[model samples]
Target: MTLPDLDPDLAKDMQAIEIRIDGENRCLAAGKVAMPEIAKGEVLVRIHAAGVNRPDLMQVAGMYPPPPGASEIPGLELSGEIVATAPNVTQWKIGDRVCALVTGGGYAQYAAVPAAQCLPVPAGLSMTEAASLPETFFTVWHNVFDKAGLKQGETFLVHGGTSGIGTTAIQLAKAFGARVITTASTDEKCQACLDLGADIAINYKTQDFVEQVKTATNGKGADVILDMVAGDYVSRNFKAAAMEGRILIIAFLNGPKAETNFTPLLLKRLTLMGSTLRAQPVANKGAIAGKLRQQVWPLFENGTIKPVIYQTLPMNEAQAALDILRGGAHVGKVVLEVP
Candidate 1:
């Protein structure tokens, strides 16, 4: 496909149809937000799509704030073509189809991202699918593999088994040879997780996940657990984890406060760790991006792993997309298709 001719003035001051927060509501509004300036080692992307994530919702509710020096816009992942590049950026050029993990500002029609944070769109993925990859894949990779060191042949348990993060974790862990167990709210969602390659799917509404994990692992317990619902699960996870187990907390969906027995920490020799991706340093995210390019990208290329999108809404309907996520009924990612 031939690229469009660039009108310098239009490129200089782009129209980003952004979601503005009104009192207790988020509404889409077209505004002339300044086109991001590319610093050294950065590239300007004419975004085709942007991913809507839980953090984006938090930001909309004013519970989460963008990091200092990051864009105030509420998107974390994007798929687009490179329109311009900084002088120091040689790895990418104009017209490259790339998906990136951005700190912020991806909700716009254009985004400026670090060269190191961008990866080529995998073969056979649509721009919307590619847009869905970065945030979930990066979060799963950093938490499950990097922080927890989830090994092959181990039992991996994840909460919210039908979420963007859950779907990515299930596929990646399965691809890498781990036996995955995930918990969901309904039998339908549980089946969805099973279809995504989970070995065991627990319907948390009906079954106690601790008992399910115990039965699945023959009372040895899960070797590693990726927990998003950390409130009460914090205590229950300790009970479900094996000796020398690792638990990585990415979010507290239920609530953060919890009263748990600390004896398991000593008895199981378990490691409990938590991280928020957006607040991490650029270097850290860049490093994770590089690893994803090398290790995980092949899985996408070979069809061993792919994003499961629940719905694609036009960028102008971002709030509607977010509402789907808030309902927690969607099985995978909710993507915003940019026009």
Candidate 2:
């Protein structure tokens, strides 16, 4: 089979299948969307694979809206070869294999990503595995390491241990010399977390995570807590955190509103912070990309860490991929492989 040539004139308008929402229904449809143009600092990527994330589901459900000036499409990360570069772009050129953390527009055949957001595909990783890296890795790097200040020899707790973010967090914290504790819903999922380098995997259905954290840390509690299920977990995480601990909230899967006592904040000297990556400035995301390249990309290159893909469906089967994610049955990322 011959690979398609990257010709700007011929690629002006390509066959880009995009997912569109019909009333309350979301479905993938064939359409002729204009090929993205390279901006001053952007590179046009011929996307081979795109990673599906929880934020995409929220966008499909009409809950999360794309930031101003971002692509209305729902994907957040992708791996592909560079097909074109903006005149000002010097770091990358056509035919470079790269993966990028995009703000939007990753569900199509091509995406115009900021040059700074793109990184060389790690040594010995397929497009599918590389595609799975950016979203979860970026989120975890920012929340767990940057904001939470997770240090070596500390006890770190992550909720939803079987999730893409959870698995990434477990591996990254362990790689940085932290003891990781994670919570999953089932025995099998708990074992999966343990297999992924978690020092302790709590079956949240059978045990209270706060109690488990306290017990595992010998009453010192977790030094850092990466939380996605915030609602009631906010109060519970407060109970599980050690003195001067940090609690970073990236999502509120249950509900954002929480009723928590301020006494813990005052007495424990704890710090609470939250962030949504998509809405952050491009420069900030670019800085994060730089850090990942320097600090985390080597992990993938040397096989010290790897993406755990639960399933890979054709790009046309994007809805099915989202269904698997919504059902919470997947142990890791659900990726969409583009032809």
Candidate 3:
């Protein structure tokens, strides 16, 4: 694999992972792609690391595609030093270390990211840990804190307690003074959730989460629920929510289809909402970056909250990284190092 030159060669090709589909299988193979151009308000990053995510798997399987004008290569988050900057960009100059949220093209030696969507790597973290932050942190902060308005002293519940999003949500919610509850597939994973500061951790495989939540909250139910498994969990979430509760959906790993009853929603006065960050406007994502920098970055700086990286693989092993993510046995973030 060729590393970028001492000075970036923006006109040349760069190594990246490309999707090759044959029959029912989608393979991540190595290839060369042209270096991305830095548009106005954008900067070209010499990517040190890129975070693997479920969306990358979905894109490889043809279930998800890059939005219009996005690069065909798949990666949602990355950390690196700025190699070049757009003429109009001022906040991030060449040589700045930043982690950014991108619509696409993160699985490469270089990615062009909007300046507003980039946040400085927190003081104590490595590039691999910084790469892990943009996606889960942004999603959790937006859905759980910004949208759901999870308040201090409120009870918060998140499914998939060992997932990248789950670990992030657990730590963030705990740091903000919320009582956290999370559900995982195993007793060990439940213990992992408890270690992340969750007040309660339910093993959904052996236990009925609805019952556990009721008992934990003393029959009042959780004040806010962050759900990624939506199928039957939809109705279950409705049952686990408190009166005037908020339920935010970010993904549907159990399948998006569900047979849901609306009676509980009406009776419980539950507010159901969902969002995806990739397709949102750059301004919206930039605003989220600002919030994380101002509100969440301090947590990292002070060691109150930290990114949890389960594994790191070479950039060329992106498929292996995705395989680890697909298998669902891993905890926290899986990252790919460019060098």
Candidate 4:
């Protein structure tokens, strides 16, 4: 098939994987769909790999849908080589390898990404490792540093420390000289967080994270908290949070709806904020990509921060990939290679 000639620098040949709903509890995966047309200010990417995320699973379950004007495909991030670029864009070429934060459509053989939302893949990282960076890293960075304003010597609590976002948050916070406290369910998961530079790892299954955190900090409480589990953890997080603290909510793995007292928030001068990548505008994603490339990419390039890949599965074996993520047996990222 002849793809649209949207970018003079883009290769004419491209392909993609698509997700279509078949019925309840069944998702039909379509492979080798036609390459996407490059819209204005967008570039066509020859996607090498894509990161699997919990949000993708939510979309598959019909609990979430792509935000307005976003791609219908479920993926949120990808790493790939540039195949084409539209007019008025410079500073990138057809062969540059990059990891991008996307609104959706990373689960494909090819994707069209806004030029401003793309970051050059670090020099030493492989496509699999690079593919793991975008969604988790960007989410953590925005919530922890940009929104929460975490500072040096402050204690930051991260839930799900063995998951992709959890591990990434631990390293990034440590890299910036912040103290990290993470909660994991298993002993091994707790150790994994410690190995990644977290100051303290709490096994929430065996102990109460709030008490552990308070005791660890000499009763001062955590300066900032990054929580994905919002149900019961909400009250516990507030209890463990320090005066004038900030809590950033990125996901609700346990549950979204919660009943909590507002007195603690008012008395402690705490700030509560929530964000999601799929729901944000292109400009915001572009700005994040630019900042991460300038600030965080060097750490990746210099070996300060690296992707912790758990497994890789070919794109065709998507169900197996989903099963692995759903099983929650692995740490770090589970990547799907297009090749």
**Residue 1 accuracy (lDDT) in model 2:** 13
lDDT by residue for model 4 (63-112), tens: 88888888777688899988778875696787889989888888887898
Off by over 4 Å in 1: 1-5, 19-28
- Answer with 2 or 4, whichever has the higher lDDT: 2
Which residue pairs of candidate 3 clash? Answer: none
Considering TM-score, which of the candidate structures 1 and 3 is the better prediction for this target?
Answer: 3
Lowest summed lDDT over 10 consecutive residues: which window, candidate 1?
1-10
- Candidate with the greatest lDDT versus the true structure: 3
Query: If candidate 3 were superposed on the true structure by all CA atoms, what would the RMSD be?
Result: 2.4
Off by over 4 Å in 2: 1-10
lDDT values, one for every candidate: 0.89, 0.90, 0.92, 0.84
TM-score of 2: 0.96
| Candidate with the greatest TM-score versus the true structure | 3
Q: Which is the winner by TM-score between candidate 3 and candidate 4?
A: 3
Residue 250 lDDT in candidate 4 = 84
Candidate 1 vs 4: which has more lDDT: 1
> When superposed on Cα atoms, how far off is each prediction in RMSD?
2.4, 2.7, 2.4, 2.6
lDDT of 2 by residue, 5-119 (tens): 7665547676555667678787666667877777789888999999999998888777888999998877999999997788788999889999999988888889989999999
